[model samples]
Target: MQAAAPDLWHHYGRTRADTDRGVPDFFPWIWAQDGGPGSEVLGDVTGLVLADLGAGAARHAAHLVVHHAPARVDAIDASAAQHAMAGDLYGHLAPRLRTLHANAAEHLEAHPDEYDVLYSVFGGLDFADPRRLLPAAARALRPGGLLAAATLGHYLGGAPAEPDVQHADIPARTPDGTPATMRRWVLQEHVWTKLLDEAGFTAIGVDRLPPATSGARSADTLLLRARRHK
Candidate 1:
């Protein structure tokens, strides 16, 4: 159920704010890293229920609610620091956006209530163990609920042809502003489909996001969209 080692992720949360500040002048405007472009790949939720797994600071959730208009969004993150930062950054979205500092699987298990949609942007689906995450997603979403997720296109250990786990790195700045690394989970494309099917989801699509024109990042990141139906 662990996505990142506690100390590593907590340190990441602690130092993330400062590192994000270094991104050009504008972020969500000048660049979009997480979900890519917009919520279009998420299909159409309109006024349906949705949850953002590993929602981080909720910029995407804010976009959906303000621009796309989901009935409500549960912004769930395993990091308390990250959750707090979300509140501080998007307090204006209170009530409409609810933040939950809980593990992705535990949160879904406890709630049990079904959601119309469950999605992530470079989020839990990318790092959390699919055995734990996908099944729990089955419990959390209503029949036919859509599940969409995006992650860095390539795996650090090369493309996975089977159900394999590889180490992933998230670059970060030290508390002293020095370079550092964080760990995460990376999986193969086929494994993802199998996991989703085993979890009670019907595979819908899997696409690799193309790199930006500037070539700042590679086209290695991939998107996985699935649906849970009875």
Candidate 2:
């Protein structure tokens, strides 16, 4: 038997989850999360089966369930802490908003053709290996189903995004306050488009959403939209 690694995301969103317990009224795709395009990017989610990949705390998924009338929105996150937090905050919306604890790629692979819409807001698309995750997403979505995700347009410290598939070891903290690093993929627009096309997606489009304001930590967001071939 082997012990599991410490949850690197254990402390993420903890402070906000405590004060803001209500389901969000809006969903932002930009990195800032303050303003930008909302759920309209997913078109009409009404009565649609959707999943929020790498949904941290599931605020956006909760919003869709409460305000958009989705048939169901599975908030999927690999982090045990995030899954627990999502349940604690919006478990009352069950049946519509279901929180799942699983790796995004593994979950999608397990539930082929299970979702009509799949979107990640700086979530799985940023942290997971696109080679595995994107193909799994393509297999998991029904033909012509939408796949939307927001990711970094460049490195956070004003560096250019990678021209090819690559992952950066970004700093992270473990559950017991130990220092760690996690892989984050921040690829250029054409790189992402090419990857999506190769992964069985069509009509791929990427939009660069510049931050509302400039700052050291602020980086542009790449909003990607595509559909599985019908």
Candidate 3:
């Protein structure tokens, strides 16, 4: 199924900078912490193949270009708008960085076993079907490849069907059309480990990026790092 959110696209495209400013402390902090994703953990990427699933506006892709300087970096997202912005943001790193427009599932299926590092940040895997997508993600990476994903952790049971009240500070629509809101589906740490194990990844690690300070829900993040086992 496609998780197209035209309304969200319109909302984000029109006010990304403002939105980023409004929630500057949280999103930027989290993005920077993951080294914008690949850059933080995937060291020695000079010649490694890297792919960012549902890369969104590719804030992480932009970071990878400057830090890891990988031989090849492919950023795929279903949103044309986000892809376009990523293209511009990564222009300085042209040829080494490329943007593709396609759903994460389709892209992973089309390029099975093609990358050394497969990951996603603040996009894609946020949905409930990560169980179905993780294997495909694992299949898309070469043997011994790494998969680093950052998702919102849902401390309670079952995916929440409603928007989260905890993220009241963010003032824009979710990349999904819901009012600038958080979905209660934030997963717990155990659920993330189980998903990676079932998908055939070893050395799985699941933990939270604690909020920048006490009593702040905005910067909380759940991180999952796993390596494929042949």
Candidate 4:
């Protein structure tokens, strides 16, 4: 979690303020990275319960509440600081937007078949082992429920597939700026399709959105929408 901040900041620093005041600017890009509103893939969830694994300041959760208007949303993340920020951001959502401090992979075990939509946005799935995380997410969703995620493309390791404006060569650091050994996985199209299939998702839709940037460092990210088979 802490390890991934430097890369996040490097790519978003220009648009995102280094402090709380900058969170708003940061969210649009985050939402964009997520391949637009979740409903485009997950179908409608107007009255269904939702869970945002790796809620990360709860930007997506807020969007779900505002746009999709789900009955409830359990926004989960591993970082306390992020949780605190989420609490501050969507605290007013009440009974609708709930914040949870937990790792997405382990947290799902406590919530088997609980959500109509179990989703993530550039969260645990892309940062950790996707194979393990997808299965866990599958276990948490109700039958026929949705599992949506957006992640880094496989080409990030070598060269930019498009242009990136906020690119920088910085060490992976915490929000406070301490360096850590970050863990990130960049997966190709086939690798993602195979992983989702192995996770018990029946109707899976994996697509590559336009690049986040168009500069020399632009690498495409993948968006996945998989449904849990009954």
Residues 2-42, model 3: lDDT tens digits: 97455344444445643442211212324225333334566
The lDDT per prediction is 0.70, 0.96, 0.66, 0.69
Candidate 4: C-alpha RMSD after superposition? 6.1
Which of the numbered candidates is closest to the native, going by highest lDDT? Answer: 2
Listed in order, each prediction's TM-score against the native is: 0.78, 0.99, 0.74, 0.78
- The predictions' CA RMSDs to the true structure, in order, are 5.0, 0.6, 6.1, 6.1
Q: Local error of candidate 2 at 216, Å?
A: 1.2
Per-residue C-alpha lDDT of model 1 across residues 58-101, encoded as one tens digit per residue: 76687777767678888999877678877776667777778888
lDDT tens readout by residue for model 2, 78-149: 999999999999999998999999999999999998999999999999999999999999999999999999
Steric overlap count per candidate: 5, 0, 8, 4
Decoy 4 TM-score against native: 0.78
User: What ordering of candidates by lDDT runs from best to worst?
Assistant: 2, 1, 4, 3
lDDT of 4 by residue, 1-230 (tens): 45443333333322332454322322232323532433456567788898888777787677777777689999998777677777876788868989998878888877799888987777777566666778888899999888878776644444532232122232466555666555566666667777789889888777777664565555555777788998
lDDT of candidate 1 at residue 190, scale 0 to 100:
74
Model 1 ranges with Cα > 4 A deviation:
1-7, 10-37, 156-163, 166-183, 214-217
